[model samples]
Target: MTSTALTDDMALRIGLAARALPDTSPARLLAVLADCIGLPPNAEKLDTLSIKQLRSGASGELADCDHSVLKTALAYLNGTASTESMPPPVPQSPLINASGSDPEGTIRVAIASNNGDLLDGHFGSCERFLVYQVSADQFRLIDCREIDDRQAEDDKNSYRAGLIADCQLLYVVSIGGPAAAKVVKRDIHPIKIPDGGAAPALIGELQQIIGAKTPPWLAKIMGQPAESRVRFKARALEE
Candidate 1:
């Protein structure tokens, strides 16, 4: 088989894995895999996949594939590739608080909801604020809001700053393109929330795994914590 054919086959397998996951983006999938493999945040380099390598089945460890097509597939999956060519560096800050009293330790998150309904229906009711606490046993919920509202203007900047600001992290619920663009422009890490069912559950599970708290609003909507379900696997794209 030619390198292109091998890549195509691998990509097909990975794509199939992704399709099994509902409301998951390739970027998010890649991020999950990267985290699992302990790869660096800036290691996504899939766009460089060549036709020669795709035809022959990947030999040895899948590291090359991991470094190339998988990374590219992730960028394509997350919808962040067009605006910025490279994946943003992972924020060097604590995603949660150690002490609720320490202002510096608080995980200041900006929940951007595209419409009031999604905010109201899915995120508003969850008791997810506890996930940000310093102690694993304790939890609390912070404020949640719509990005376009009157009060949100100032908060938006604050939220953007928090993503890169020392000890803060940003959480995005259902907002899209323009909003994502604004956040990314600030060099903040923006996590897109998946839709209902297993996706939300999977997110919650990952949050726990990462030792970060889920938003109180998200917890409430999810009702019950779901298992870890990876929607896609990295594969070299066909030439």
Candidate 2:
């Protein structure tokens, strides 16, 4: 097949793979793309697909496709295409479990990205924020906040932080110390995931963390609800 045809066909196959998924939101699809093609986990720069059309598109498994071309395409779109030959893509995760048990506790997160899916946007110029409600059992996308066109550049970062003020954590590829401090001042933790991965992976991993043996940081941010705590106490008394 011609290169163009191959790419289009491959893209179609990938889309089909995506559609096979139970949930095909752009954020979810991009996370799957990152798993399948070695795309870094946040909304950076992928021209082949945009986050705006994520839910409509599909992604599950691009099994038995050309790895070389896939690598080149991902690198090119991500601006990492080099003269040297691309390496083989790392193995991708097949799916993200979107369903959750009961959100033992909820941790709202903001991921910075040029697109809604990749964690590629820097603190200075991200196009939007994809907000998610995360729990050990399941997670769901709750909102997408775009940068205001009328907001001055100087105040935009702070404004963006405000947009996700209810969120507990902010994940970005990079952020300045001052901006991070500003986020912390608002009681939101800013985590710099330089090697951004898919949001589902990140969120799922955190869900596991909270569900299993939680770290101190996670525990602090995820205090049990009063009812749950009360129930636990009642159960302890019964025992």
Candidate 3:
């Protein structure tokens, strides 16, 4: 089948499916398609392709692929994946720490997310911000901020930054330079996780850092003692 036979929409779907699969290239995915359901994969072929067939055909390309990832890829290929079904439900009510108290050692963080508590959204395009109150030992989902149509107007970067201005750290799959600048201007550190994963898992990693040698920047955010901050900073500089 000629490349031209695949429409732009079909090509886009293939690209997205390829991205879903670990270490898969579009060319390799196309090869798998050819193996699974003959040449020139079209909407009909993709829509009709079975998961068993896909898994069988991907033996070489996705030998170590996670089952959920493979399923997501196939869903994308069949055009059955909907962004609406991806995200996890938010808390029924806001659970902010309203007693005017800190949890000994805690800082607020915002995670850019589109799917079910996954840190999988770019700063500019994520559907919502999952705000959490976290300490070295525990965390709680305090708020869920949605990016509505109203916020789409005028300096979107500034607006998005302002939405989570109270957060000390922001986690995202990606962020543009200008957006990062805006976040930093608001005294929020923007952290980019190129391959996003579960927010809780990422937060666990942060907790490890906090429990261990907390970085100077993090220490400052947690309002640690000046001596502790200086010690960490000196060690970091020495390293």
Candidate 3 local distance difference test against the native: 0.78
lDDT of 1 by residue, 19-85 (tens): 3232234454444544343233222333343323322222322232223233333444333333221
Model 1 ranges off by over 4 Å: 1-106, 113-136, 145-167, 196-207, 211-239
TM-score of each: 0.28, 0.51, 0.64
For all candidates, the clash counts are 24, 19, 2
Cα TM-score of candidate 2:
0.51
TM-score of 1: 0.28
lDDT of 2 by residue, 1-239 (tens): 32312254345444433322222333555555555334443323354543322322334232222232234234533444332222222222222345743244667888875543656455655667777777777777776677663574667557777888878889977676677887888888888776676776787777877664555566576775555555655665676
Off by over 4 Å in 3: 1-84, 92-99, 234-239
lDDT of 3 at 197: 87
* Alpha-carbon deviation at 31 in model 3, angstroms: 26
Better of 1 and 2 by TM-score: 2
Which 10 successive residues of model 2 have the least lDDT summed? Answer: 85-94
lDDT of 3 by residue, 54-126 (tens): 7778465655444555676788888887524475656543344568665668888899876788886667666
